[model samples]
Each structure stands twice: as structure tokens, then as C-alpha cells.
Target chain A: MQYLSVVDVARHFGRRKALSQISFSCAAGEMIGLLGPNGAGKSTLLNILATLIAPSKGEVKYGDQGANDGADVRAQIGMLGHDLFLYPELTARENLEFFAHLYGVTDVHSTATRALHTAGLVDRGDDFVAGFSRGMRQRVALERALLHEPKLILLDEPFTGLDQTSTAALVGRLRERQRAGCLIVLATHDLDVADGVLSRAIYLKDGRMVGSDTGSSNLADRYRRAMDRGPRNADSALWGGE
Target chain B: MMRAFFRVAWQVMRKDMTVEIRSREILLTTLLFAVSVVLIFSFALVREGRAPDDVAAGILWVAISFSGTLAMGRTFERERYNDTLRALILAPADRPAIYVGKLLGLLLLMLLVEIVLVPMVGLLFAAPIFAYPGMLLMLLVSGTLGFAAVGTLFAAMLVRVRSRDTLLPVLLYPITVPVMIGGVRGTAALFQAVPDEPMARFWIGLLLFWDAIFVTLALWTFEPVMTE
Candidate 1:
């Protein structure tokens, strides 16, 4: 069954079309990669799915349910975006504890403790996040996203500033969540990471889905060729960074 | 749900308290600023033999109101520095939970600063501030609640705009004038040993009514502003 679906989603910021007639769906436990260039509406689409921004026109459904029931949809999904969501002045443990309370976790202390260990910051859990490196902060953010044990996890460029070890740990954790029947949608510019991490690929150009493939072929090559052959006018405004 | 609200409020307040202890920057700056304002007021008005009873309430509320803006500005600065507020917003909890949490934290900080400033002002100006403890306390509670309630919403809005540090007071002071007047009149009545006066009760009633109205407005408006 489809756990997530977007139909003809369109969004405009002022006069510019940030996303236009975009559509996609994901089944239970599927890891779908959203590949696109800068301003390709990857973040905008992710934002719509995360319910952070409303679609100009379209429908978003979760678990075969309709979009109008947003609270139910929101309860099942977890999101990690480009922004670092943890408080800087707060210690890592305090940050986690705070989020745990926000999400109404039954066992906040234990949940926070386990999250700190998973992020490889067990020793530094009591230290303020202001003192953390980008990698450490990202780990804390990941821990925060997973604290609720959500059913659908949306990640936007989750690999931007991580060391190799941290990256591997994150990938491993993501795979574990995937295996446990969590649907994942990741948006990224790095084809290599997406190729290695995602089981299926969706290419976006000019604020619309341009190509999609599920095979083990070179997705990047296919994506580049698709872009080259695509219409020039389809995405001129996005290319201009409007 | 009330339990959840208070729990989040307590956690937010505790977290801010911990940060305040570590930095001591906001508390120290607001306190010094409040004290200096009082001293300057002494030079400007106290030498005229203006009865302490006449301007005592005005000076006290003005000092706290101005310093309160400084403290409220710091609330969002701490969150923006680490992007923590964004994280809090994204959590599965309701938006009002976050609003109340931050509101409670700001209120606590403003009250704490007032606790120290009230006694210090009395000592500095040699007024009988504690003469009517009940009236003085009533003024503190009503005044601070109104200030913090409106200040929280404005502070959040200003946090996103440029020149937020200066913009908060400029935008906030005019809107808060009625509350200041109410607070001053209420406090002055107490200083004059007129605890049973109807005017003081009327001003206190006005402050309470305004506090309820703005707090609801703040709650309704905060969700859109924060999400946007």
C-alpha cells in the first residue's frame, strides 16, 4: 500500500513557480531519492510533504488517507531538513530531553540517552551544542528526528556536512529504519550518495518530475541525458534563480 | 493537555535558566541598564524636589519596562543563534505548546529581573517602596504579565526582521503605553498609602483585562508568524 502520495502538487512563491504539477508516491519501506540541481524544487517538494508549506494546488495523502486530516498525517511522519533544529545554548541531553517532551515520548530520559549514544556523542551529551562541530550537531539533529520513531522519514540533503564515519553511521541507521518498514524520501544533489543509498530514483527538472528509474543502471548518466534533452523553457526561471 | 503544556513550559524555563547561569550576559546587562536609567532619572528629576511618591511608580515601571524589552530580545537571540526554535517548531507537538513554553520562559526572566530591580530602586531613591507590600506586589504581577505577554509576540516578529535589537523597543513602547500608565497609577496609589482607592483597583483591573486580551492575540498570531 502507498504510505505517501503527492498528486499534481503545484507551488508558487510570488511570480515564480517553485514547483509545478509535481506528482509521486511511495510504498511501505521504500527508499526514494529525489535527484535535482539547485532550485529544482527538491526542498520545496520536501517542504510540502513535511507540511511546512502548503501546496498551491494538489493533494497529499498518507496511509491511503486523505490530506484534510493533517494531524493524523503529521503524527506518522518525521522530518529532517537543511536547518539545524537543536537549540545551541542547550546541552545535547537537554535538547533531546526537550524534544522528547514535545513529542510526548513515554520514557524521555532513556530515549534521550539512547539517542545520544546513537549519535556517537554519549560523552558530550551534557555539553552545549554551541561547542559542537557541524558533524556533531548533525548527529544530534538526526537523533531528534528519530526520537518519535516515526513511520515515514523525510530527509533533505542529510549528508551535507558529515565526516565519512558519521556518514556511514547515518546510512547504516537509515538502512535499519528502512528494514523496519519506514518509508524514506531523501532529496539531494549528490548522485553518488543517492545511487548508493536509494533503491529507486526520481529526477526533477524545471520544477517537475522529468524522469524516474528503478533499475541498477547508472542513474546519474540517465539523469544528465534526460536534462540535456529536456525543454529549455521548462525551467528557465529556476535556472535564473528567481 | 494542560499537563503537557505546563511540562513543556517548565522545560523551556529550566533550559533558559541554565543558559542564563552559564552566560550571565543578559541578566547583567539588563540589571546595569535598569540601574543606570534610575540614576539618570534621579539627576534629571529627583533634584527638583519632586516628591518620591509623585514619580516613584513612573520611574519603577519605566525602568522595568525598558529593561524588559532588552531581556525579551535576548530570548529569541539565544534560539536564533543555534536554530533551536526552528527545531522546536518542527516537533510533533502543537504550536501553542511552543508558544506557551517560550512565553513562560520570558515571563520568568522578566519577573526575576524585576525582583532584584524593585528593591534596588527603593534603596537608590530612598522611597518607601516596601511600605505597602501587597500593593507593590500586585503592581509587579499585573505589570510584568502584561509586558511579557505582548513582548513575547513582538520579540518573535522582530527576531526575523533586521535591526531587531533596536526595533523591538521602538515597536513595543508605543503599544505598551497603556499598560505602563496603568502600572504606574496602580503603584503610585500604593505608595500614597491608598490601598482601598478605586482608581488603583481600576488600573489593576485594566492591566488584567489587557493581559488576557493580548495573551490570546499572541497565541493566535504566533503560529502563523513562527511557521512563516
Candidate 2:
């Protein structure tokens, strides 16, 4: 079943067209990478999918439900962006507990502990996040995002600040979540990570998608070629053909 | 629904208190600031040879009101610093639940500050703030509710602005003048043994009206502001 869908999605920040006629869909148990360079509307699309921001035009749906059912839709979705959404003064356990409660988890302590263990922070769960290394903090953030066992996970640049070991661990964890029937959409500038983990990839340039393919090698080569094209008319390529 | 609201409110309150317990910066600073303001007022009154009764209520409300702003600013600062405000908005609870939670938390802090200020102001200025204890408490509750409602709204709005620190007070003070005026007068009436004074009743009604209107507005507006 298609778990997520977006059609004709467009966003405007004042006068700048952040996204125009963007359309896509994802099914259950799929791992897709939204590939793009800077200023390519990656974050904007992620924000719209997460329901953190509204689009100027278009419809986004989760399962069969429309995005206007924000609170209900939000219940089934979890997101990790570049920002570490945990409190610095809070311990990893406390941070997880807080988000768990927010998600209306009845057994907050147990859920939080499980998430901490999954993030490989069971030992450091008692330490304040302020004292944590960047990689450890990212792990805690990942745990927070998964606390509710969301059916759909949206990650925007989730690999930005991670060390090598942490990055591999995160990828492994994401793969495990995908295998468990959660639809995962990750937006990243790192092609290597995308090539390794993503089953499908979509390349975006200048606010429009240039190419989308399932094979990792083809997608990476097409993404690089599009990037090398050096900022041409994105609208003419992605939307004009459509 | 009430259960959900209270659960979120209690959790937010607990989180805020834990942070305050760990840092002790907000409470200590607000305490020191409130005391200093009272002291300054005392000195000015003494040098001018004015009776404590003349400005006692003004001094108390001024201290409470200004310290309330400091408390609100700190609340938003903590949320913004940690990105917890965004996390709260994304929570499953209804939007007004977050607003009420933050407002209740601020009300508690404001009451705590008032508890400390009432006695200190009475002692330092030699005015009997606690003379009509029940009436004084009522005045405090009414005034604090109004302040918290408006302050929470403004704090959420200013959290994202470029000049939020200065913008908070600039936006808040003008809007809160009526509450300040009504609070000081009502408090002064209580201190002067005029429990049934017509002016005190009028101000109390005004304060209550402001509280109801702003609390409703804050709850409605907080969702958009927090998301934005």
C-alpha cells in the first residue's frame, strides 16, 4: 500500500519559489533517498512531509488520509532533521521520556529505555546531552524520533555530524527500521550514504527533480551529472516534461 | 481531554522545574532583580520623605509585573535554546494544551516570585501587604493570571524575532498597562482596609476581563506562532 503521497506540491517563501509542482509517493517498507544540493528544496519538501510547514499549493497524504488531518497524521510519522530536538540540559533518558509522553505513550519509561538501547546509548542515558559528543547526541536524537514506533520516518541530513562508526550504526539502524515495514524517506547531500542504503533515489536541482531511478549506480551517476550541469533551468527539465 | 491537557502541563512544569533546579540561574536572577527594585523604590521614597503608604502598592505591583516579564523571557529562552518548543508543537496533544501548560508554569513561577516579594516589600517599605491576607491573595491571583496569559502569548511571538529580548518588553509592557494599573489600585485598596471599595471591585473585574480575553486569544494564537 502507498503509505505517503504528494502531488503538485509547491511552496513559496515570500516571492521565492521553494518548490513547484513537486509530486511523489512511497509505499510500505520502502527506503527512498531525496537527493539534492544546497538550495534544492530538500528541507522544504521534508518540512512539508513532516507537516512542520504548509505548502502553498498541492496535496500531501499519509496512507489514505489527507495532510489536513495534521494531528492524526503526525501521530504516525516521526522526523529527524539537522537540528537536535532534545534539550541539552536533559539526560538522554529524560529527553526520551519527555518525547514519549508527548507522543502519548502510556509506558514512557520502558519505551524510553528501549529507544536508548536501540540508539546504543543505554550506558550514557543518564548523562546530560550537553556533555555528549556530537555523534552520541545524534544517536539520542534518532532514539527520540523512533520513540513512538512511527510507521513513516522522515530524516533530513540525519548523517550530517556523525563520525564514521556512528554513521554506519545509524545506517544499520535505519535499515532495520525499513525492514520492519516502516516507510523511510531520507534527504541527504551525501551520495555515498544514499548509494549504500537507498533502494530508490530522486535527484533534485534548483527546486525541481531531474531524474529518479531505482538502481543505486544509475541514480548516483545521474545525480552527479545533474549537479555537474551547474545550475540550469530546473523547472524546464522536471515540470516542463511532466 | 482535560486529562491530556493536565498530563502535558504537568510534564512541561516538571521539565521546567528540573532545568531550573539544575541551573538556579533564572530563579536567582529574578529574585535578585525583584529585591533590588524594591530597595531602590524604598530609597527613593525615603529620600523624598514620602510615606510608604503612598507608593507601597505601586512598588509591589511594579516589582511583580517587571519580574514577571523576566520570568516569561527566560521561559522562551530555555525552549528556544533546546528546540523543545518545536518538539512540543509536534506532540500529539492539542495545541492549546501546550499554551495552557506554559501559562500554568509561568503562573507558578510568578506566584513563587510574588510569595517572596510580598514579605520583602512589606518589611522593607514598612507597609502591611499581608494585613488583609485573603484579599491580598485574591489580588495576586487575578493579577498574575492576567500577566501570564498575555506574557505567554508575547513570549511565543517574540521567540523567533531578531530583537526578541528587547522586543518582548516593548510589546508586553504597553499591552499590560491596564493590568498594572488595575492590580496596583486593587492591591492598595486591600492594604488600606477597603475590602469592599468600589474602585477595587472595578479593577478586579477589569483584571478578570483581561485575563479571560487574553487567555482565549493566547490559546488560539499559540499554535500558529509556535509553528511559524
Candidate 3:
């Protein structure tokens, strides 16, 4: 019955604020799409949730526990960021086996094989990832994320570099996981992809949450209207010109 | 929990070994670099009328310290390429296990390189390296352990820095001064035409102490530094 919640979390890198006063709560079976343009802090928020970096203020609670309860929270979270996080020199199977051990997965060989098959890389399992195409590497990365069956999956720009076929495979797998009661947070700039897959969409602009709803409407239109405010900060160069 | 920790460590080390087996990049580069440096030192140090013992120890450790840096750099370079380090950090495994696994991998490479370098040095310099076999082994193991322990941590720390290639040695050398001193002093004692047993023991103990302290600190700081 526990849920993941973010309460007034803010993160700043020196003078630049990456996120501010972002608040939300999500439970299992919710596929929340984080919609934002470039520099909108979507990735930062996901990273915070993943505990890769801590928020500067406020708190993130997983169930009743907070970020300070590191291991328990980390054990249940899986993240795919801009970095593929796959070792190029390691074969796909080897990569999975190594991470399987880390995640305390028993029967590493079987788990790796199943994950590879799911990603459609079973035949190429023994091949070094260095030789893989960008799309292929992305598939392997997706398999790595889902290998441990984490309760929360954070996908930041997961669709990048993926072809239509691979993208469909990823979307299908994501939907399947959600149906199995996994909490998924997908952060992307592609409203079309978000529209097709999300149960709810949250729009962010300049580190602030502008709007969030479960309405069945055009996400792009909603995004534009939510961002109708001219500029949140006139002096901030990010919104200034360019 | 302890069993899981070591299992994760072994898996990491095994993965590194498998990748190394395929490419042999770190092995080839570190060996060639170490041998080349030693050969250069042998040529430069041949002054008329003195035994190789006089300069052998200093030159040997110099080769190792420099080439060991290269090995350390290569060990972490692959992780940096695809951001695999991030994956390792994100894993539910203990972060310090990653350090131990990498330390063991570097130790394996360093020991392998030394195996060749030691015999090659003995042949070239005509020094009786076998004079104090036990002491020599102890010194080499302790020194390499200290080096790899600290080097692995620094290498991981520098992975995110912009000037990491240059920063590694800059940060590493200052911290590893005690280990280098112990290695060089111990080697000097052993390489002497007449061995100094007590001097060698003192440096060996120093190397052990250095390994104990830095490795403990490395374990303590690895998670924080890596996560940051």
C-alpha cells in the first residue's frame, strides 16, 4: 500500500537551479509521462528519484521511508538515463550477468538469457556491445533496466536513437511492466510517444511543474497552453533568447 | 550480506577479466609501457664500474609507479566510455565492492607485469633478485596492494572530472608517496650487493601499514566520492 512521493524537492547546481518545488506522488500501476522541452529538469527529477543525486531542499519518500534510507529505496528502483550504462567491451550476456550478480539475482545465466530474449538480442548475446548499433545498444540497456524486476522504473529519454521497430518493442515491454503493477516514470520531450503510452502526463518548464492531468486530450495542446506564460524568469538566459 | 558483497566483487572482477581477455588492451599497453621504461632506465643508468644494484631499485619502482598509473587509467577508461560506472553505482550492490573488485583486477595486472619485469631486470642488471625471495614478494604484494587500493578510488573519483587524464597522476602521486617510498627503499635494500635485512623489513612493514590505512580510507570514501 506504500507509494513514492516527492514533496517540495529542489536541486541547484551553484547559481543554476535544476529543479524547484516539484511535488508529486505515484503508486504502482501508474505510468506517469514527464513532458518537458530541453532544460526543463525532467532528467534531474528522475535522477533525484533514482537517488543518483540528492535534492537541495525538501524530501523524497519511498513508502514511509525517505532518501536517507538508501539501500531499501535503491533496491526497488531501476533507471535508464542519457548514458546507456552498458559496457561496450563486455558482451551483452556478460553485461547482464555482472549486473545480475550485483542485483542479487539468482540463476544469473537464466536471467540474462531471458532478458536478452526479451530485448530481441538473444542470438547476439555473446557479441561485444562495442560492435552494436546505437539502437541495438539501447535495446540491451532496456533489458538491463528490467532485469531485476524493480518496482519503480525511471526512463529518461528512453526513445532516443531507437528505430520504429525497437521503439515499439520498448513501448510494449513498458506497458507490460505497468500492467504487472510497476510504477513507471517516463521522461521525454516527445509528446506523441507520451500521448500514446502515458496514463497521466505532467508538464514541466524551467524546473517548475506547470500542469499534470489524467485527461484524454491532446498532450501537445495542453503542453502549449500550460507553457503560455511568456517567461518565468526574464533574466535567466535559458529562456532569454536562443 | 557479507557473502553477497564478495559475490558481487567477484562478478565485477570476473567481468573485467573477460573483457580484458577479449581485448588484451590493458595487458599489452601496460606490459609494453613498463618494459620500455625499464629498458630505457637500464641504458641510462649504466655508469662504468658500478653494479646494477646501486640504481636498480629506484629505476624499477619508477617504472612501476608510472606504468601503474597507465594501468589505473586504462582500468577506468572503459567504464567511462559508455557510462558503465553509473550503472555500477546504480546497482543495488555495495559500492565498496566495486572498489575491491577493481583493486583486485589492477593488482592482477600489476603482478603480472612485475613477474616479467622482475626477471627481465635480474637478467639485464645481473643483480641477484632471488637473494631475499620472501622479502621481495612481500614488498611487491604490499606495494601493489596499496597502489591499486588508492589508485582505484582516485580513478573512480576522477572519472567525472573534465581533466581526468591529467588529474589522475596529479592526485594519485601525492597520496601514494608512502607506498612508493616503501617500495623503493625495500627494493634498494634487497638489490644491494650486500642485503640489509632490517632495512628491508622496516620498509615492508611500512608498505603493509600504508596498505591498511589507505585501503580502509578508500573503502570509506569510495561510495561518497563515486555517488557525488
Candidate 4:
């Protein structure tokens, strides 16, 4: 989990190429954002990194190991994809407890209580997830993904259903994780929300890594410039990300 | 490693059971569907003064197979509805353990349905169910295990498919032919006018062999089949 090296990674669905020759590497404490227009393969790249799907042509090395290294390495990884991955019928506490057991977390009862408390849903812990609001569910889902305290956390549109306050809370949580030396890779369209938290933003366009923006201020402007000014030739998608 | 594997399986089974107990969605639906199938046969085949000879075995297996398919579809449908299967797959626990847990849960549901359907078939068709209860129980357990082993795998594979409801039985029945044959033949031998204990015992052995093979194959393939 010290280094995530995606080397010449490509994913093709039958004849259609979802990603090609994309390479990037990041270390602990770095929060990298995958930024692009829709269908730019942001989610595809995240799936590849999460080991949920295999890349067609390259390797995503989680430190010195990869998906072929067996699932013991997965204990260091956590993911929140497009699906919330929660059962609506189960209470929030039940959901957390079930997952905690799967992840082999100790002190199941107290661990679930702590997760519910972190989600700010301790009072509603006994309530079914079906009855919870979208933001509430999102918060609980995030806590569920983090239950095992994974070093590598992949999030896709983590702010989608959040209000302004929840968004701030999420950003704060990400900051805390970042400060704790966990690597966070996220694909999000909310540039303003991500502007301050991301150390580097990787731009992808048409299944290739087009450019990156590492500047601190005016993220929206930088993103526009990166999207518009990048070379459009076949070979120009090649990028050496820090 | 064995302890961890079984521990995860037990937790998964417990979770499914808890949900089932509270909702009873799969259990109630499966029980009613099975009873309806048996009742249809009772009305259609049972004559004024006599029941069709050996119709009991066919009726029992048919009801179990049809209702078991329904229960499997509903059970996995609940998982795919919220994409919970993906969550379960993402866990660090052994993937085969998840498969076993689901199979165990489905087997339990089908067994509960069989508990009612078996006696109903006996009373209506005048089959001597209690005469060979021990042999009959072995046939049911082995037959159900083999069926569930294959059915659970296919049901899980179809969860993300658009036409999963129409597809489960289509895939399950063909692969579980051995199980159905053993169950029907074995149960028939016992319920006949002169119970053939040896025949029933042979079929039970064959059913158990099929169970081991189906479960091993299912466990080996569950991870790959489930993967995207």
C-alpha cells in the first residue's frame, strides 16, 4: 500500500477500448483525483485500481503486489463505486456489523457502534437503511467502506448525494484520512469541492490520460485549460504523472 | 484458514436467516407456490376412490424444483436489488465461503418447503412416507444439497443479467438432472406398494456422490463466474 503503480494499463471491452496506455503512480498521504468529462473512463480506471476488474494490457501494482498476488492484499484496499452497496432492508448497525465480520474487524458490537457514531446516525442505527435520506445513506456507506481501515480508498463521486454540510464533512473526513497517510483516489465531477483537498488531479479524455493539474488555486480554470489545451494526437494521451 | 472460512460462512448464513425470519418473503412465497403445485396434482390426478400409483414421487420433485427455483431467484434478487452481492464479493473473506453460505441458506429454505409438501403428497397420493422415513430423509437431504449446490451458483451468475427471472430454471434444471433423477427414483422406491430399500439406498448414494461433485465444482467456479 505504500505505492500504487499503474503501468501502461489498458482495458478493452471486446472491441471497444475503455482505457489505453494509462500510467500513473502515487504514494501514501496523497489524494489524487481522476477528473474528466463523462465516459472518459474515470470509473473504469477506478475499477481497475480497485481490482474489481482487470486491465487488458498492464499491471496495477499495489506496492510490490497486484491482484494476482491473491486477496490478502485486498485487506489494504477499500472502495465506494457507483453503487452504494448497502441492503435497504437491514438496519444501519446490522449492515455495518455484517461487513465488519466479513472484514474480520475485532469487537464487532463496539466497532459497529463506532461506525454508526461516525456516520452521525447512532440514534438511527436501529432504523432500516431504506428509510434513510440519500445523504444519510452516503455517510453510512462511507463508514462501511472504511470499517477495515484500509490504506488505499477508492471513491467514485463521493459527493453526489450530499448537501453542502455533508459535503464539507466528507471533505473533512478525506482530509483526516489523508493526514493519517492513507492514499485516496477519487473520480468526481465536483471540481469546487475537490479543489482544496486534491494534491494532484489527473485528466482523462477519450480513454487516455490527457494531462494533470497540480496548482493550488483556480482549479476550475486549470481543469478547463487542461481539458482544452492538451494535445489531441494519438500519441499525446501518454502522460507521466507524479 | 478452515476456521476463518467456516466462520465467514456462518456469519453470512446467519445474516440471510435473520433477514428471512423478519421478512419471510422467500419462505412464504416458496411455501405457497409448492403447496399450490401439490394441490393442483391432488385435484387433477387423484380419482374418485383411488390415487394414481407412484404419482407421489413425480409430484414431489416437480413441486420442489419449481418452487426451489422461485426461492433461489428471489433470494439473489434481493442481493442484486441493492448491489449487495458486489459488497459481499469485495470483502476480504474467501469468495467460496460466500457461495457456501448462500447455498446453505437456499438449502434451508427448500427443506422447510419440503417439510410441508412431502406429507401433503403422502396423504393425497396414499404413499407410505412414514414407513421408510429414515431412507426418505437421506434421499431428501442428498437430493436437495446437490440441487442447491448447482442452483445457487447459477442463480448468483444470473443476478446481474437483465432476464434473470426467466433464466434461472433454464440453467438450473439441465445441470441438476442427476439430482432430480436420484430424488424422484429414490423417493419412488420407498413410496411404492412394496418398499424397495436397496433401490432407495443406491439412489441415495448416487445422490450424495453428485452432491460432492456439484458442491466442489460450484465452489471452484463461483469466484470466476461471479467476477466481472
Q: How close is candidate 2 to the true structure, as a TM-score?
A: 0.93
Please identify model 4 stretches exceeding 4 Å from their true place. A229-242
Candidate 1 lDDT, tens digit per residue, B21-100?
88888888988888888888887766555545567778889889988898899888878875567666666666766777
Instruction: Provide the lowest-lDDT 10-residue window in model 2 chain B.
Output: B46-55
Fraction of true contacts retained by every candidate, in order, equals 0.53, 0.58, 0.73, 0.64
DockQ result, candidate 4: 0.65
TM-score, cand. 4: 0.95
In terms of lDDT, the poorest run of 10 residues in model 4 chain A is A233-242
Clashing pairs in 2: none
Per-residue accuracy of model 3 over B1-228 as CA lDDT, tens digit each: 889889878888888888888889998999999999888877777667344556778777887888899999988988888778888888888889988998898899899899998887777776668999999999999998998898999999998788999999999999999999999889888888889999999999999999999999999999888754
Candidate 4 structure quality by residue, lDDT tens digits, A13-88? 7766778889989999999999988878899998888777778899988888888765676788888866798888
Instruction: Supply the global lDDT for candidate 4.
Output: 0.89
For residue A30, model 1's alpha carbon misses the true position, in angstroms, by 1.6
| Model 3: CAPRI class | medium
Clashes of each: 0, 0, 0, 0
Q: Write the number of the candidate with greater TM-score, choosing between 2 and 3.
A: 3
- Interface RMSD of every predicted model, in angstroms: 2.2, 1.4, 1.1, 1.3
Candidate 1 whole-model C-alpha lDDT, 0 to 1:
0.80
Q: All candidates' lDDT scores?
A: 0.80, 0.82, 0.86, 0.89
Tell me each candidate's TM-score: 0.90, 0.93, 0.95, 0.95
